[model samples]
Target: MLKKTDCCQGVVNRKDKDGNTALHRAAAKNYPQMLKLLLACKADKNVTNQAGLTALDVARGQVNNRESINILGVCSFAGVSTLYKLWQLIVKILTEASTEIFQDMDGISSDDRNALLVILGLLLTATYQAILSPPGGVWQGAVFIVAFFLTLGLLKPFPRGFKTALQVLLAFFAICFQASIYPIIPFYFYVPLVINIFIFLVFVIMMSMCTASRVSKISVMVLGCWLLVGVIYQSFASFGS
Candidate 1:
């Protein structure tokens, strides 16, 4: 849609039979980078679909990511088997971390901070190198899982501004790391990158929403700044090259 027509006009004119624009679809599909891009192109945020659903409505549906997964008639492994496996592992990590966050002190007494720190350290190293090196998606996936745990570690009882600081660090590094990977990944796979990055944004936002700390809010803003700058700079640099 963005390719055939100017982004602004396409978003303006393209609506479902139900009167939803690309923005509606993007939000429904949990595509924040797409949402940001559409908004940048002046998409009408106020526009309601035929069902009277706003972008926020669609985003809200994604709040419970694992819960809303439709197992019925959903072929889990017929296609993209490796990615499906990866998805399962990612979900497991997210779910476990989420559970740990709410668990009691006595329950968390079993939580190994050293193990967590080691995993987080390893993930940062692994993800940074994985993109620049040969195909090591397994390692990359491990990094993602460890990072999810790291986020959980920061979430519970966050002090004045720790959660926010961690998110900014994660978002900044993730953006930079992914930007580097973009050049290596075939342009055809750009959609996956877009979709996952959108999910990343959603995860970051969720972390912000769940936390009462002010730093989390600040972190979101700073991460947004980095994403915006990264996108613009990447586009210009890539185009010039």
Candidate 2:
């Protein structure tokens, strides 16, 4: 139909009165294959409809349809912008970490659970402090402290999954704390690297000592191996540079 129509009237890029191309309609309806076909045929993804929305914007607004969003996220012409892509990558990493942490938390003793929480709390405090006072100046730390206390109060009554999700989020923040300062204090690059190494060791040791399921142990070991490989790669890169 597209070939016939294009050969007859060149309607491939033609728009209705609303200025929407076939690409826009396919993206709005979440027809990923159709969108791909249209794109291959040189359909304009950047063209806006009457509402001033491109195909990418239309896909983004379909929050309930993640398939459409993911499809558009990888499209060359309609891909997510740089900042949005970074945000998506962060969310994906944290989500995978949260799943692992949730699995590891199961079957652990109350004491061990409390210990992990304390470590996370301390890490959170350190990260939050780093954020407020990167290297040179000091700002008000009361907000994070108060927020931590409030979180504790709220977490006490929540289910295990929710608590684990919060912990994973805190861990992510703690890990990213050094990255936030790496640009400002490039000379002190090793500070955050050492902190991250310490945090990794603590996590591994805690996981090993805990009474988690066999699957959890395997998951932790897999994560440890992945991190070890990353560390080795970075070490080699640093040395070679």
Local distance difference test, candidate 2: 0.53
lDDT string for model 1 (1-241, tens) is 5433223443463677888888777767766566667765666555557776555555556765332233111332233434544754664565465456444522343356545556677777766777677654433644564575455454444443565566667666665665665566444445445635654665554444333222344555655666666666655655555
lDDT of each: 0.54, 0.53
- The CA lDDT at 227 in model 2 is 56
lDDT of 2 by residue, 103-218 (tens): 44456677766776677577557646656563532222334334433333334334645555664453344334433433443334574466447546545443432222112233
Q: Count steric clashes of candidate 2.
A: 0
Residue clash pairs of candidate 2? none
Give the runs in model 2 whose Cα sits over 4 Å from its true position. Answer: 1-158, 181-197, 209-230
Model 1 has how many clashing residue pairs?
0
Cα lDDT for residue 132, model 2?
Answer: 50
